[model samples]
Target: MSAPRIIQVASGKGGVGKTWLSITLAEALAEMNRSVLLFDGDLGLANVDVQLGLSPKHDLGSVIAGRARLDEAITKYEIPSVSGAGGGARFDVLAGKSGSGVLSALTKAEISGITRGLKVLSDRYAHIVVDLAAGLDQGVMSLCMPGSTTLVVVTDEPTSLTDAYAFIKLLSIQEPAADIRIVVNMANDREHAWRTHAALTNACKNFLGLNPPLAGFVPRDDLVRDAIRHQTPILFRHPQAKASEAVRRLANDLLLPVPRPATIISTSSRK
Candidate 1:
């Protein structure tokens, strides 16, 4: 049997730490001896490479451009979670490619190739966390649509809240019943974070008739900033810190047992 694919982490606005969450979750899952693949699906402004401080020999853009094969473009990084956190398995990353000019339009054949590669990787990896670009791009939406779980990360600010609502609204229109998850980052405390979530949930219910699940809340901490500056995850840099502990708990809750689809049977099968 293939490994389980649960969630794909994303955000409405940029610079809200969605990428950081993705990296942390990947390491978190890997620490549990679960195979994790962190795919940089955010085509524009891809920074998984920058976050890890590793210069990739190739990137997904190259694969999309037909300039490099998928295997050749993928790079592996050694990310450490908390001490005695878990078994500490390995993590693979598909960095986003950078380019300009009229690259070949992503054709049907190319899309199929990419999807096939992702399915193969998903079969082996315990978790496939796709880091989508902020905003509502059709390409990003297509990639995010297949995810059985979706995480929407936001900050406790007016603009962040607005964007969060906009993102949820768009997704609800596209996939009305999608199980959207919410994460309020940079909060002063749990209460403040929950308030932000309440506002978001209320908006979703009032307008879109949906209530997104609260995946987790991360507190604002100097440790998070410090780790970012040092080019390491907070879990590794300050494992004992409160913010780090919260993130660890977030990861555990996500990786914990949950009911999944009984089978891959399609709508046509029921007929």
Candidate 2:
């Protein structure tokens, strides 16, 4: 059988709602009947479970330490009910290694083993969304550099744009054919979101000679925060909300048949 597709959701810096997008996208895919496994690739920071308001007993650390098997670390989270969807979505979540100590103490061999295990485990799902840690560090690059589709999340902040550029540049050097897609999150308006995408793409083209594709943008909506407060994904919590609708549209766009260098169309043009 063909292996499952893996998508690495990453950002230049933290606090760009990377995890939020990661979880919601997985939820959206699940709603479409695509069995998904959302791996909390933040490894050490492991908060995907927290965001879902779950307290997983076993994590990757447990598996690595030989205290538990990989199956034990995987948790089954039935997605929230969808109104028009056939049935409530159901997917698995592989928790990350919780705590800072585990983060620093992790060896390359251990990480390599975990990565290899992921490759074997991926065969069971339709999609594996890995929420990578921000930055171009070894841990982050190890996951992003592989043969996985990438989604770079960015905002309007100068720092966010520059850092994202720097991160993509490094990745591009390593993988010249990498047509990483850009997602502008927390954008104030259509104009602002397009500008952010343009600025980042221009820098990548002019400086690094790489032209990243613009996937889409998520507008600044209060419903996103409200859903987060309730510990539920907006895709299900308030599907009618602007942010939720945007994400669902993105979900559909992603499911379209397309090849590299021709990523999903921007949400603005789809309207």
Candidate 3:
């Protein structure tokens, strides 16, 4: 069988560190000798290229403009290691169209093309992690369908909680097959993060009849902001930090095999 192709990380609100986590997870998978490709699915607010500190000659713009095919627009990153020997995962980014207009509005044919492109990359790599745009944007949702594992990120605040629920609710209605993965960022501890997820999941189950799964949680840490300012991922900057550990654990958790849930979802958990 082909190497496990699973997971696509997203959040209801921006600045929830989705991009950072995607980059870090890519690195983590690479460290484990698992080839990974971090797809910049956030066509509108594409920043995975910046986070990697590399400027590509082309982006998804080339593909959308029809000037270049999907294969031509692809960029590769050869991330060097700390030791003299350097090897890292190859990052393929789809940085959206250059113009503001809805370039290549994800038609079924185009969507199939993109998914096939990702599979091609996955054949060479073990995991393909997509960094989605914040909120329930159409461009984001179109790619994060029920067939894909959707990781919804949130914070401990009330606004984040409510927004997380709303985001999942919207998605659950549009894509019933979507497996919701919850990860609470900027939490004080695992318990706090779990509480945040429980609240949001309960609300989704109660009102929308959707039961999202608990994937992982990332704690609050100053080092995350520091790494972002430095244009480096926390996993590379401070792997020992609480948040870093959480992200590492998250990578493993996401990699774990999750059996498909039965169609029936309990109403008690919905509320």
Leading candidate by lDDT: 2
Candidate 2 vs candidate 3: the TM-score winner is 2
Candidate of highest TM-score: 2
lDDT of each: 0.73, 0.79, 0.70
RMSD of each: 5.7, 5.7, 3.3
User: What is the alpha-carbon lDDT for the whole of candidate 3?
Assistant: 0.70
Instruction: Give one digit per residue, the lDDT tens place, for model 1 in 84-187.
Output: 34324468888886443222245545555666788777776778888877877665566654545778899977778888888777776666556678988888
> TM-score of predicted model 1?
0.84
Model 1 per-residue lDDT at 116: 73
Task: Please say which candidate is ahead in lDDT: 1 or 2.
Answer: 2
Could you tell me how far off, in angstroms, the CA of residue 94 lies in candidate 1 after the best superposition?
Answer: 0.7
TM-score of 2: 0.89
Name the 10 consecutive residues with the lowest summed lDDT in model 3.
84-93
